[model samples]
Target: MRDDIVTIEPDEGLRTWGWVSYLLHLVVAVAAVLPGAQVSIALLVVALVIDLVKKGDAANTWQASHFSWRIRSVVWAGVLYLLTSWLWLLFIIPGWIAWGLISIWFLYRIVKGMMRMNAGLSVETA
Candidate 1:
């Protein structure tokens, strides 16, 4: 049998951008769960912008799933936080607990996505 090997090259630039976005997300997520250690919202916005802008570039590639994953995580967390805002009016403790849970969930998603990306796998599969 004739042997013909085909090798596909990975996109380094796309991976680099993915790492940058993931790091930004990790920072924001970690800070969110910490008391009195709030980080600037601008960092989250910047990460979102990077994901939105570069998402197109990753289309039809494995990295595309990561972009979508991060975007969805942020959107869902925002919605959850908004819905739970009324708890603050009722009682400060309830509000704190709701937000704290949401923050932990956000942190979990970020960490999971980063792990999948590092493994050169699609977040969708996880």
Candidate 2:
């Protein structure tokens, strides 16, 4: 039996930034779900740029992972959107299917990442 325990020291700055990142993701999700995809996508891009800029300054693995997760989500969603948009003219149904899948993926990443953040666990990229 292993009796070792792990403890994470709290950092107010990282926690605050983490919450800000998560809230931005939430805004993107809600806006994307409604009729504000354009605005949400622009916001998402801005959020991603901030994540990239600040990731190097993160104090711990947990904080870095959150930024990485957010960046991955934004890039994946953007690529998927662009691909679907380009192909929509040829196959409308497939485009819709791709969009739906992307939305689910986006939501899943944000929810899971936030939950892990709250639990003091690092986000798993894999």
Task: Enumerate clash totals for all models, in the order shown.
Answer: 0, 0
Which digits, one per residue and each the tens of the lDDT, describe model 2 over residues 82-101? 87896689988888777877
Clashes of 1: 0
What's model 1's TM-score?
0.91
All candidates: TM-score: 0.91, 0.78
Candidate 1, residues 53-122: lDDT per residue as tens digits? Answer: 9998887777888999999999999999999999999999999999999999999999999999898788
lDDT of all predictions = 0.89, 0.75
| Residue 12 in candidate 1, Cα distance off native in Å | 1.1
Model 2 alpha-carbon drift over 4 Å, by segment: 1-10, 34-39
- Give the Å shift of residue 83 in candidate 1: 0.6
